[model samples]
Target chain A: MKKVQDSSIAGERSVTGEFEILNQYGIHARPAALFVKTASKFSCEILVEKEDTIVSGKSIMGLLTLEGSKGSTLKITARGTDAEEALEALRTLMENKFYED
Target chain B: MNLKKALTKDTISLDIKSSSKEEVIEEMIDILVSAGKIKDRKSALNVVIEREKKMSTGMQNGIAIPHGKTDTVETLVAALGVKSEGIDFDSIDGKPSTIFIMTISPANRTGPHIQFLAEISRLLNDPATRQKVLTAQSKEEVVDTLQL
Candidate 1:
């Protein structure tokens, strides 16, 4: 998993990582809510791409379609003014294991 | 807008249990009905469930915001629930969640829905806030933490 430091690129800044959706049922209701909630934090235009599917990080419906299973690998890309901050924040969320015990 | 109008003390649940996402949505609908947030619990639940059939709402982190926009509601109302024991929510984090924030609103109140969602997202992203929420023992504490 490579964390892109420079988010100031003209086009979209991309960060790819393997996030294990630690929840047992795998990206169900409550977790989806949390993901949407977290994604709404940044000013950047965020997208989570899994397989061939790409979704707006801010949309609950869009996130749900990813079908993020346990131990799934996700490629999160951010664009816009605060893409760097958004990428860092998202990386924190994923690296912290989404705060799961 | 009116945060007071959006939430009532009665709409919150401290600890809740449900084996599956469907059951959790049912629980949220029941809470909405009891709080007078919605008219028909069954139909309201169906709306959320149908939406979930399209996609799972599990964002990373031990939190889930299951929401539905339907004409059945008069305004935007939210119900917050916490499961200390953790439930199998199939989160992107691959872990069970201890927190559940459920939002139900009229189809017209998109602005508040987005605003509220953003607020919750920003707060939960903070490690300190997430820690406080995880250790919170009561609904009021949970609300206070999120409201910050």
Candidate 2:
């Protein structure tokens, strides 16, 4: 993963991405669990935005509540002390198909 | 959140055949009812089905965790099952799921639900755990592997 320094602020940094859930079955319990597990590893506060709702990335229930389906579009944002690192971690996870194993 | 009290061995089913989402959920409701976990099968199925209508419970990989929160449930409960033949779940990863983890909780109990999700997720994320779960020969093996 490439690390990009924030240009907008002296110290503040953020990473954002729009991920499309490509799995045939949308985000279910297991995947939600995986997503949350990955998100919890970072110090940054992760947020998943779907439609009009925004939820804590660390909460499985919060992610489940979004009811993200196959082909659904989600905007994932992470911001905190390690916002850039957090975002990169999540981006890699998402790009790897949420590490479906 | 006291999963032992909520989870009964009777609530778990082994080698069930379900070609559709409703069939799978109906099987889950049957388990809940037979185990005295829920009084109204129709209502409980409705709650779960309603949630499914909003979005499929199929996750990445070959697993699906269908869940719902309803007044019909007296406490947090879980039902684990396996479909060796795999089912056509609308999974995000486009995979047929061989395992199903169905959960239900009272309408007001959010903490247990969150905790359950986290624990289950953690377990599934482990490659060793996943291999154990996938290779288990019987329901007892699956249950023992989960050890929740």
Provide the lDDT at B35 for model 2. Answer: 80
Candidate 2 lDDT at B83 equals 76
The C-alpha lDDT values of all candidates are 0.68, 0.73
lDDT of each residue in B62-140, candidate 2, tens digit only: 7788888887877788887777677888865567877788888898756667566656665665557767777778767
Model 2, global lDDT: 0.73
lDDT of 1 at B147: 72
A1-101 in candidate 1: lDDT tens per residue?
55454534556554444455554435534455566667777776778878887777775545655666667767777777666677777777766666654
lDDT of 2 at A59: 67
Docking class of 1: incorrect
Cα deviation of B62 in candidate 2 (Å)? 1.4
